[model samples]
Target chain A: MENLLGIAIGAILINNIVLTKFLGLCPFFGVSTRLKNATTMGLAVTFVMTASSILTWLVYEYLLVPLHIQYMRIVVFILVIASFVQLTEMFIKASSPTLHRSLGIYLPLITTNCAILGVTLMNTVVEGYSLIAATVNGVATGVGFILALVLMAGLRERLELADPPQAFQGLPLAFISAALLALAFQGFSGMIL
Target chain B: MKFQEFTKGIIKNNAVFALALGLCPTLAITTSVENALGMSLAFAFVLISSNLIISALKRFIPQEVRIPCFIVIIASLVTAIDLFIHGYSPTLYEHLGIFLPLIVVNCIILGRAEAFASKHSVSDTFLDAAGVSVGFALAIISVSAIRELLGSGTIVIFGHEVVPAFTSSPAVVMLLPPGAFLTIGILLALLKRAKVI
Candidate 1:
């Protein structure tokens, strides 16, 4: 239980998927243009990250490791993520069209988001997390990603209103803002589990 | 044909600055010049080989199943690279670790395979892949140089000290994750100010 809490906190704050680990950055900048879209993308990612981590963990421990073909993880993991996205699309279309439309294109983009793959890989390879531990870490990391995205979206909205020099207008300015935010988050690095 | 392939990737359609693909390594590995060079070479090996094979076998692969096909070929190449790196350069292999295999999912390789290689000739595809890889290497290495010097107060490459240490305790954040973000963020702004990117 203590280990579980530590992993969750560490994943969310100490080793944040976006701000700290540098995982899932594409969506951090891409989908963060609007608050609503950011929330929807966050929820969608949370769902996928949790599901895929569990799936990958079970496969790695039972199937890949036992078979002595750990090299196949990249192939297997990608195939699983691609197919899982397709499956989620079908399920959402059938079960919740409104939610599906809300998510729209971001749902497909989730397939490429490195956070999901990063968590799964970190769970199996880096931390040697068990199936349950991987699931917890996965969900926590997703929540962390969502937190970073929301924070970034809020700041970006404000930046759009603020005056800036010509050179820092678009992506460049966005990056500068991220730099400041990252500096602030560095304070959390010293937190004790 | 030669210039078309080379120029497309270097500037106009440069993978990092222009295309904005593959930001993970662009941020993570750029913390050190050594890691940056290692990653770029690793990525180049995977990208060029995958492009050639995928381009050569373009006809046999079905459109409906093309993504999966490209992934398998790319994954095999990544696995091969992963093993070779582990065997030859254990230190680099340790530093690169997950990022190495994660190359299989890097949108750049699959993006090029789907967008360029699937339709272009094998030779042109090779050039395109090489150009993009070099362009990416340039970006990563440059960022790493700035971060290593600033974040660590010294620049060391492959266990050889290139410069004397200026301070005992460097900022150290530059070696951390957020520092990666901050460094790239500022660097991008500087480039924009110079109108280079």
Candidate 2:
């Protein structure tokens, strides 16, 4: 239990998917234009990350290890992620049309988001966590992705009004803001140990 | 073969600075110039090889299944490089870590395969891939130079000290995640101000 909590906290704050680890940055800047969009993207990512981590973990332990084709993991994990993303998109479309409309656009994007794939590889290949531990880390990393997105979204909403230089208007400024946010997140490293 | 096909990716369609296509590795593996070069080599191999194969086989791959087809091609290439790096330079492989395998999902590679290589001829696709790979290399290396110099007050490229210790106490944050963000952010702004990007 203590180990699980440590994994959760470490993934969420210490090694945050976006702020520190630098995973899922495309969506961090892309979908962070609004709070609502950010929340929807975050939730969508959480669903996929948690599901795919478990799926990939099971595959790695049972399939890859048994076959002794550990090097095939890179190819296998990505294929699994891409297909799972497609599956989630179809499922959402069938289950709820409105939710699908909003979240569907982001689903395809998530396949390349890196956070989902990063967490899966971390679970099975890097960290070798158990199935439950993998699930916790996946969800916690998604929460971290969400936290960074929400924080950046709130900052961006206000940043548009406080105009800086012309060259620093768009993504350059966003990058700068992210640098500050990352610096703030650096504080969390001490909190853990 | 028009030279513009190659030049455009270097400037107009730069994967990192102008388009911001692959920020994950642009930030993650760029702590040292050596790692930046190693990543560029691996990235260039995958991008170049994948573009050639995808372009050559574009007609054979059905439109409905092109994306999956491209994923498989790219993933296999990445796996090959993963093994190559692991055997050739264990230190670089260690430093690169997950980012090495993570290249299979990099948006730039897949994005180019789907958008450019799928439509253009094989030769043109090769040039386009080369140009973009150079652009990515330039961006990542520049970020690494700034970080290594500022954070450590020294720059070493493959055991040769390019920039010696310039400061008694360097700002260590430049080696951290914030440093990657700040370096690229300011570099982009400066390029914009200079009308470069």
Candidate 3:
């Protein structure tokens, strides 16, 4: 239990997927302008990451490792993620039209989002976490991503009222803000587990 | 062999700066010039090969499953490159870490395949891929050069000190995540001011 807590805290605070690891940056900048959209995108990513982590863990432990075809993980993991995203899109479209409408294009975009693949690959290959640990880490990473996205969205919304220089209007300003946020997140590195 | 196809990706539609397609690897593996060079080489290999294959087989791949087909091709290429790097250059492979495999998800490769390769001829797609890869290489190497110089006070490439240390103490922040963002942000602002990007 203590180990699980450490993993969760480490993933959320220390090794944040977006701020630290630099995964899933497209959605970080693209869908972060609005708080609602950021939240929706975050939830969608969390769902996919968690689901794919477990599924990939199973495949890695049971199928790939036994067959000695671990080199095929990149192709296998991505195909799984693409299929999973497709299934989720279909389910959302059928079950919840409003949520589907809100998600819109971002739903499909999650398939290409590197964060989902990063977490799955990291959990299995890098960290070598077990099935349950992988799931926990995936959820924690998603929450960390949400935390960063929400914070950035709030700052961007506030920036709308302030005037910046002509050269630093849109993306340049956002990059600067992200730099500061990244600086702040760095302070969490020394925290004791 | 249109000249415009080769020239456009360098400045007009740079994958990194203008289009902002593959920021993940752009920020992640660009800690040193050596890593940046290795990454650019690998990326160029995958991009050019995948573009060639996709453009050649564009007529056969169904429209509905084109994305998946493109992905499978890109992923297989990445895996081959990953194994080759691991076998040949263990140190660089270790330095690159997961970003090497993460190349499969780099939007630049897939974006090019879907947008240009699917529509253009084989030779045109080849030039397009080469141009975009060059653009990406320039962007990442520039970023990595600035980061390494300011962060570590030296520029080392392939076990050689290209730039001697200017100061004993450098701003270590430039080596961290914030440094990557700050460098890219300031670079973008400068490019805008000069109207270069």
Candidate 4:
């Protein structure tokens, strides 16, 4: 239990997907302009990451390991993520048209989000976590991603009012803000657990 | 006409600076010039091969499953390069870590396939790939050069000290995550100021 808590805290605070690992940066900068969109995108990515992590864990443990074709994980894992995103898109379209409409292109874009694939692949291949651990880690990573996105969105929202130079108006300033946030997160790296 | 397609990717539609498509590898593995060079080679290999194959097969591929098809091809190419690096250069393989496989999701490759290669001729696609790859290489190499030189007080390329230590103690923070962002941030601002981007 203590180990699980450590993993959760470590993933959320220390090894944040966006602020630290630099994964899923497309949406990090693109959709994070608005708080609502950032939250929605965050939740959507969390769902995909968690779902794909569980499914990939099963595939890696049962099928790939048994077949000795573990090297094919890159191809297999991406296909799984793409299909999963497609399925989720269709389900949302049928059940909650409003949610689907709100998501817009970002829903489909989730298929290409490296953070989803990163978490899935990291859980199975790099860390070799157990099923429970992988699921927990996936959720924690998503939470970390959400935390970073929401914070960035809030910052960017206010940045709209601030006047700066022409060159650093948009993305350049956003990146500098992210740099500060990343520096602050660096302090968390020393925390024990 | 041919040269136009090639040159555009290098400057007009640079995968890193102008497009910002593949930041994962750009920021993750650029701690040193050696890693940057190794990554650029592997990225170029995958990008060029995948673009050529996808462009050649664009018409035959069904419209409904085009994304998945493109992904499979890219993934296979990434795996091939990944394995080749592991076998031939163990040190680079270790340095790249997961960012290598993560290249499968690098938007640049898939973005090129979908945006340009899927519609263009094979020759055109080849030039586009080469141009984009070179552009990406230049961007990452420059970023890595700045980071490695200032952060570590030296620049080491493939085991040789290209730039000797400038200071006894460097600003080690420049080698961390913030430094990557800071470098790119300032670089982007400078490019914007000069209208280079």
Flag regions of model 3 displaced more than 4 Å. none
lDDT of each: 0.85, 0.92, 0.92, 0.92
> What class would a CAPRI assessor give candidate 2's docking?
high
| CA lDDT, candidate 2, residue A150 | 96
Off by over 4 Å in 2: none
Instruction: Give every candidate's TM-score on chain A.
Output: 0.97, 0.97, 0.97, 0.98
How should the candidates be ordered by DockQ, best one leading? 2, 3, 4, 1
DockQ of each model vs. true complex: 0.68, 0.89, 0.88, 0.87
Tens digits of per-residue lDDT, candidate 2, B61-165, equal: 999999989999999999999999999999999999989988988999999999999999998999999999999999899999898889888999989999988
Stretches of model 4 off by over 4 angstroms after superposition: none
Q: What does candidate 4's lDDT look like per residue over A103-142, in tens digits?
A: 7578788888999999998998899999999999999999
TM-score of 1: 0.96
- Shift of residue B87 alpha carbon in model 4, Å: 0.7
| lDDT for predicted candidate 2 compared with the true structure | 0.92
Q: For candidate 2, write residues A115-154 as lDDT tens digits.
A: 8889999998888898999999989998988999999999
Off-target runs (Cα >4 Å) in candidate 1 are: none
Better of 3 and 4 by DockQ: 3
